[model samples]
Target: MSPDADPRSAPTSPRPSGLWRTVAEIERHVATDGWGAPLRLFALVRTADALDRDPGLARRLPPNVLDEARADPDHLTSVEQEGVPAVADLDELLGQLAWPDGVDGAALVVERILVPPDAETEVRAVTAGDDEAGRARALAAHPLAEDVRIAVGVLRDGRHECAVRSRSKDSDGEVATGADLVPGLVGALAATLQD
Candidate 1:
């Protein structure tokens, strides 16, 4: 089965039940810091039988899907493979999610991208270049390509979010998002289960 087709292939889980609280903290940061680009959130969930109870899986799934996993979970199925429809009211959206009878756990991967305010001008310049090399060079110099800060975070079955990857001025270049970025809050939303 395709990795996206099987939840068993999903990454190991993060600390359960801590994801939501962690997410709340992250959200506050996002609210204050604000995103320079649109933030996207993706959720991956599998059947309860599939998780096999591995504790660390789903704790750190990147925003992208996994190609393979060591041991696939049983009765694996997809809950929401595509990006969530809306993040405008992320807290309210997360508050409405719940796992049905068959689902075991899930991972929430949030990506916040920041493009330099002047990216459009740079892109136009790149497109106007006559040769491939010139175009490539121009594109490389664009803020969207180089001057970008991405925050990626994963939250799983447990309530709390964990292991964030991000690019904040404060973070020296850690792969995980910190409070300076907002994936933590997004992670919490995905891990949380509400009525």
Candidate 2:
């Protein structure tokens, strides 16, 4: 599926579902560190399941967090993966990943430069003969290009959600949330959860 031309027009929810909440939380967490950050991957687990498997975690996690999990069966806890290697190709990186059985879902947060539909032809012409680095530079320098951080989450059961934060509209309230905001990334994350 193709992404929406204007991600800002995507749906937003005051009370998001479990997967949507997790994806939006990941996006906000990444935003705290500012831009130019590396790609981040997280394993989503049902909070109650995790606490049940290791009751000791109850002491480690905040009381409010534990309470919420107990109240909501769908609550999810995001466990970030560390020491991930930097890769030029996102698809290749995702292709190499396979989650363990305990992971109920997976999420990815990444930054990208987007050119508006009106500028697509000009963008293609500008970077036509350029190499990877040259093409990146050309796109970054494009006047109409936008910098956005996208968070996509997918469950083993096929549920998916996305949250997008454009640099220009940096506030948390302005974030756009929907299922198909980033269809390609959602598909990639789903692939990693395959058995």
lDDT of each: 0.44, 0.90
TM-score of the candidate numbered 1?
Answer: 0.33
lDDT (Cα, tens digit) per residue for candidate 1, span 116-150? 55774556564754665555566666555533333
- Candidate 1 Cα errors over 4 Å, as ranges: 1-80, 111-161, 168-173, 177-191
lDDT of 2 by residue, 69-186 (tens): 9988999999999988899999999999999999999998999999887676676676657566877777788898899999999999999999999999999999999999888888
> What TM-score, computed on C-alpha atoms, does each candidate reach?
0.33, 0.89
The TM-score obtained by model 2 is 0.89
lDDT of the structure predicted as candidate 1: 0.44
Q: Candidate 2: deviation at residue 149, Å?
A: 0.5
